[model samples]
Target: MTADLDQGSRTPLVSVLIPAFNHEGFVERCLDSVLEDPYPAKEIVIIDDGSTDHTAERIAQWVAAHGSEIPVEFVRRENRGIAATLNELAARSHGEFLRIGASDDYLLPGGLQAQVGYLLSHRNKGAVIGDSIVIDGEGNRLHDSGMCDLHGADKRLYDSSDGIRRAVIGHWAIGGPVTLLRKSVLETVARWTEGLRIDDWDMFLRLAARDAIGFIDVTVCAYRLHGANFSKTRHTATRIVNLTESREVAMSRVCLFDEPYRTLLRAQAQFIAAKIAFLQRRHTRVALHLATYASLLLLSKLRLHRTAHVHAEGA
Candidate 1:
């Protein structure tokens, strides 16, 4: 734990890493939310990922205006994707924990304090994620993400690999932007995969495999859903191909030690492929993928049944 000299208290430093890319309109508001936080021990690291707009300039102006009130570091670089930018930001961070901040999103009041306190007290947790409220481009509140509802009523701790796998595979209950992770976890896992579009999800799975994750039952941040959000491209052919390839890469790495997990991942991949093929109107390809999916599912169930029968006989 690092002590804050100004506050004369023991508080871990939380690094807010913002990867800005062409978000000229909302970047200032994002910075404002972080700077206004009551948490005394925090730093902001902003990396402008080759924004052609005035995003970098806006960041500079904000820093100039509030540099004395808060610690802010800004970096400008050529066009790299989110993964590369996140890697660079993580390397530059000096905090014990890292919070990823999208330029278009803003944290709710007391978010940092709540997350930091939870992580500091819970030594066994590798990361802490909270619920988020969805907002439109103009910052109008849409609705809660219902993450807390999905996770349960109270704060939950996921300690087992199976729990993590099921949480990720079954519903994807954790939100990346609303989560704060221990920096040591990243050190152990190396860093984000440089070129993968789903790098956040992949990293979360790896971290969960290594250590426990915590869920805080509160709305800690606001996620902006705008026209330019990356998820809007989900139905595109290029994005579908990328999603399939990325899932394969992630599953290959994590499923190496567990056959059941591998089988489940294979089934998921086939199901996704079937959906893509159906969208493309390839009837033959769709049928083949669906058949493969069903067969894999049945095989997985049989394996589970055999294991259960053996355990029952032993009992």
Candidate 2:
């Protein structure tokens, strides 16, 4: 669908997409956070993925209360997984930019302004990601996110063509909720990869492969950590396995220029596999994966050191 921008207006429209699945307790706060934002041109789209809780009712109540203030659309569908819900939302969205909101996470004030401004200024960038604060289930701030703590006020524009590939190969560098993506860039990549537990991660990698991700140093959102979170659930082993496999599949799709980059990605995947095998108490598999992990790590280090030495000699 086309974005709803007035003929006379130059301000780009943004679509805030929320896929709700059973987050009854915190959904209102999440919705309120976005609604309270001062962005002049924006819309909220909520899709209730067969929530068994009162999430649907809460969303309905929210719409009734604030529907007139902002354009809001609500839909209820069977329990399609996260990837499918996101794809459907993308199809219905009418925004030049898209913010994927989590039902349990809250956007901080000025989040849209910060991200949208960056994207507008850097037309070549496909997405802009800000930092986030990690909060507890009760909405109490826990700490700065890993990205914030690691970067510590460095606001650098990354050419994801190489930077993002290296970052993801080493670790998960982008915060999902704090990102605002150009709709056209997402369309070029065809959106989220379906049926993977870490489809968001996959999407990030694919989009980065196309070389279009930016970073903003400001904290633009709060990511709530709760027991119900998929990463914290009792099925940790299964989730870990899915994560490893997803990384493997995603890495296979990208063609890295250097063999070392490919090896690092393979090592990271095996590291996750080793963790899962250890968790499941599969001794034989764990031993094999651990050996592979160590060897790969050594090789990666050696390669990096050699590259550095060559650069130093050139300097």
Candidate 3:
């Protein structure tokens, strides 16, 4: 009983860093969800990134109402992008464990405590992430596992560290909000890469290279799938830019990997190019890029299989 009580008392502080944009109607729920989490030691650090709507106003109201209840550091700032806002929030946070989440999304009950505990026990992991429940704009349950429904990934792939790392360039099933990271690891990666709308991809790619990421088979967040969600926009130009940025980010990290993995990353870049070409109605370019992408991926797979077979025989 004494040891259990001591462990409970020693629960590390988790900084729930939220970057708020124009999520006026949803910011309060996001704040409330943090409070709802059963974690004993936690703080809220939120920055409104130049929201044109009443998001800042809602944040102000929530802080006013709940300031005395918890440690809250709230700021209303000019319109910088998400990456910039996340960097500022990370700098402001002073917690042993950090969770950077979207203001439009909410953390589930006990999620903070569970993730923190997982990291405490798993010394090999610098960051721990879990699945998220995908919900509609009206808060209706769309899918229990965002990894499966939204990310189009095999959920079981997240069961192992190697699986998650391989998926970094292949599937990208990790959710940004559900990840609980150590301050040291975030600092090691130098935090979010600014000047890119597709920022998290670059950061995670860096994390994967360092083998600093882990996963838990739990649903810890509500990933709201509203029309305005970053990856859901129908605007053709925005899609093109996002795809291009993704390719650039992947290409930048190829130096960290060797032969097969490097080829896989390059193949992913080519796949993204094919997507962009299709969007631009350059069917010929799409065909060419797709062919090269497929060929590179197949070669990588064959080499990987051969290596695995040799290792098995050696063993």
lDDT of 2 by residue, 1-315 (tens): 012223363668889999999999999999999889877889998899999999999999999999998888899978988999998888889999999899999888878887888787777879877778888889888778637453343233243345555675556756538889998987677778778777877777666666677776677888887888735545876666676676576457546436556677677767777777877788899889879978987897788788879989999
| lDDT digits (tens) for residues 1-315 of candidate 3 | 001123544688889999999999899999999988877788999999889999999999999999998999998878889888888888898898899788989999877877887788776778888889988888999988989888798866666666777788888777648888898887677888889888888988888777788777778899988878755557898889889989999889999876677888899999999999999999999999999999999998998888889889999
Ranking by lDDT: 3, 2, 1
Residue-level lDDT tens digits of model 1 in 101-136: 999999888788778777777778788777888788
Index of the highest-TM-score prediction: 3
Maximum-lDDT candidate: 3
Arranged by TM-score, best first: 3, 1, 2
- Badly placed stretches (over 4 Å) of model 1 are 1-9, 146-161, 173-176, 254-259, 298-315
lDDT: the better of candidates 1 and 3: 3
The models' CA-based lDDT, in order, is: 0.77, 0.77, 0.85
Q: Pairing residues by index, what is the TM-score of model 2?
A: 0.84
Q: Give the distance in Å from residue 180's predicted Cα in candidate 3 to where it truly belongs.
A: 0.7
- Winner by TM-score between candidate 3 and candidate 2: 3
Candidate 3 to truth, TM: 0.93
Task: List candidate 3 stretches off by more than 4 Å.
Answer: 1-9, 230-232, 313-315
